[model samples]
Target: MIRPSGRTDSRLLWPIAIHPFTGTVEVVFQHLKRSPPLDDEPLRRELMTKLNEIEGVDLAEAKLDLRPSFPVEVFAEHSEEICAVPEWFAHTVALAEARRMPDGDPGTY
Candidate 1:
């Protein structure tokens, strides 16, 4: 699981999951009370591009899915630490480490 920073609104959250078997990635955008009026296609595209740039991974073979959700807002206060490092950044690091392996086998992990 990865948490990304940059959400100013306390009600907004983004979570991403990557499936190793099918190479499919799911991105979820959670809004507490309201949903964004616009689609998050640009952000998703940027993430896809970055992931595809990793060695040993074919972007063409990777599938990306976006999901949006709205949940009731119950919190009285917001925390600054709610957002964490973006998943893509960690994925890139992992990919780099995998490439350093003898056979570049990501499955070894």
Candidate 2:
């Protein structure tokens, strides 16, 4: 499940992964070469604002990972990044689930 940032009509959502050891939060966003790219600066600001609103999120250590979106038809190897704090991850997932589309479907083109 993913939440809308209300930044645009784009269906993309950010999934944050926190590194406790490094004290950093990584915002994972898909970068599709065929499509118009997401504006990173504004996105960083928006996400930072929401994250900092959390009781103990540290704003200074947030990072961005703009990874390429893999083709579904083509088999590819991938691994998910891990989050350090379970409660924070749960809260983020819940927020995403709440704003997600019904029937667990991604938005249509």
TM-score top scorer: 2
Q: Write the per-residue lDDT of candidate 2 for residues 1-109, one digit (tens) a residue.
A: 2124432233333345445565444545433222222244554455445544444444453243353122221111211112323334345434544454455444431
Candidate 2's TM-score reads 0.30
Residue 8, model 2: Cα distance from true site in angstroms: 12
- Write down the TM-score of every candidate: 0.29, 0.30
Model 2: how far residue 62 lies from native, Å: 7.9
**Which runs of model 1 end up more than 4 angstroms from their true locations?**
1-12, 18-38, 59-109
Kindly list the per-residue Cα lDDT of model 1 for residues 17-79, writing each as its tens digit.
545565443444332112222124454556545444443323342334434211112111211
Leading candidate by lDDT: 2
TM-score of 1: 0.29
Clashes of 1: 0
Alpha-carbon RMSD, each predicted model: 17.3, 12.1
- Which residue pairs in model 2 clash with each other? none
